[model samples]
Target: MELDVHKPTILVTGGAGYIGSNAAFLLSQQGYQVVIIDNFKHGQQFYPDWARVIKCDFSDQSILDQIFTHYNVEAVMHFAGLIEVGASVRDPKIFYEENVVKVLKLLNKMQEHGIDKFVFSSSAAVYGTPTKVPIVEEHPCNPINPYGNTKYAVECMLSDFSRAYGLNFVALRYFNAAGADVENGLGERHKPETHVIPLLLEAAQSGETFSIFGNDYQTPDGTCIRDYLHVKDLASAHYKALKFLDGNKSAVFNLGTGIGASVSELVNMVTKQTGLSINVEVKKRRSGDPDRLVADPSRASTLLGWKPEYSSLETIIADAWLFYQKPDAVLYYSDQSYQQSSVF
Candidate 1:
């Protein structure tokens, strides 16, 4: 579907973290009037000026009311929530409140203001322990972890709200969100980073050893395999999802390259990209582990006309390396002369 081509006001929640900011930046470039809502807890480090950024916690309904009033928000691309899996297990309440309740709050505000077009950021975690390879949209959702469960729960809520209140929504279930925007404008910069691409990139740049979680999975590499989609591609999927939300079409689509890479395979990719040898120590596997999780994004392609461009591992690593040295992590480090990751 072609965009409206007329710049219209759109609200973006969690507009500071990796994907949201990139979306905002690209939206602005596409001539859309964008408004951002983000709590600075995780966004302070990488906030973007591509849109009118308004910092507020989504749990506060009062604040959402004020924001909708202030911005004349036409539509919303919701990305506000806690995202770490292990951390979600430790603190499920925050995830539930932020992902579920806050979503309802946002919808209430949207309904009150007579706004309804919503593009939600859901996750493949919802398809926890899939019954088959290349999980489809129809796969049974049994999210083993709190993070996945919360996402799945919110998807249900959105579907219900759409039925009950005429809420036009699109839920994009994304796979491993990796890579930085190549232009160094917007990229992943999670604090105490847990993401493999950014974490590996940081370790390589800082000259530190990255710990591998385990090395005894059923994959050929003896490590867990994951489909690593570049963050920019993820943002583009959001863009597609946003455009897909027309006058009367609510949908759900998976965003992925439909391929899996093991942890060691990723480390080797980084090594190959940087031409630098890295150290890794394998540890015990975590409890909620899926041997191989790859998504079949046929629906996204068929519905949203979305397909990943940076589907190669080398491109992901090379682009990420540029962002790390010049943009994303340059301010965080003390030493500037080092060209590669090693013990400083």
Candidate 2:
């Protein structure tokens, strides 16, 4: 299915998170009418100032009515939900309530309102430790934790709804979303930083020690390896998916760099880029992390024409370093900026 692409009204849910806000910026630049909804659990500022941003949860029907009435929301890009993997295990109910139940409610409201097109922000975590390497979109989903389970469940619901309600959707499964909008003005910032790239940047800024979770993986470097994709490329994928769904058909795609970098390998890259030494600490393995989680993004390439551009180890570390020094970058990440030497 293809779209007119001349103009479209896009309502972006969770448009305040790392990927959501970036995606919103790209949509606006592409001449799409953009509306954003966020709960601010992970505060995002500078929401493409051009976009109409609403500060509230979409699970609330009242706000939904207002948003629907205000914007000619022809399509929706769903990104609002809890994302902590470990925490999900402790509070599976919250994960279900927030990720699964809230989505169901949102979909119900969309159906009632006759809003059918949707683009979901799904995760590759649904694959867990795959039995095969370079896992494809067709790989069996055997989520090891509640976070992954919730995303998988949502995908299931989307499939169910597409058949039963004629709801057109494109569910994007993300492999590790890293880096930022290199040529644009958006970047990654998360409070209590958990993502690897940002944490490494923070440690370099503060001269603090960075932890390497379980350095005994089966890789050559003996540290966990993950497939890291630049967020800029990812946001593009969302926009393309939106157009794809608007064609009145349903599809799914994976956004990844098609390459994996080990934990030690990433540290080495950061060290090379910033010339800052980071102390490394190895801890026990995180419960749900697979030793390796690289993606086979061939399906997306053949389907959505999506590919990551800045995921090369050098550019990924450098973009994160630039955001570490910017103020707007602080809103999404922590407020503290690492001391800089005015020269990179």
**TM-scores for the candidates:** 0.89, 0.91
Best by TM-score: 2
How would you encode candidate 1's per-residue C-alpha lDDT over 1-344 as one tens digit per residue?
11232447788888877788877777777778876667768865343444555556754576666656655566899887888888898899988887887787778878988988999899999998888989899999899999999999988988998899998899989898877776645666677688888788777777888888778888998899899898888878877777778756788888889988999888989988887778778889887788999999899988888889987888888888777766344232222231222211
Q: lDDT scores for all predictions?
A: 0.78, 0.80
Off by over 4 Å in 2: 1-7, 45-47, 182-184, 328-344
lDDT of 2 by residue, 30-64 (tens): 98878677767775654344666666786778777
Query: Runs in model 1 with CA error above 4 Å?
Result: 1-7, 45-49, 70-72, 327-344
Question: What's the residue-level lDDT of 254 in candidate 1?
Answer: 84
Number of the top candidate by lDDT?
2
- Displacement of residue 21 (Cα, Å) in model 2 is 0.5
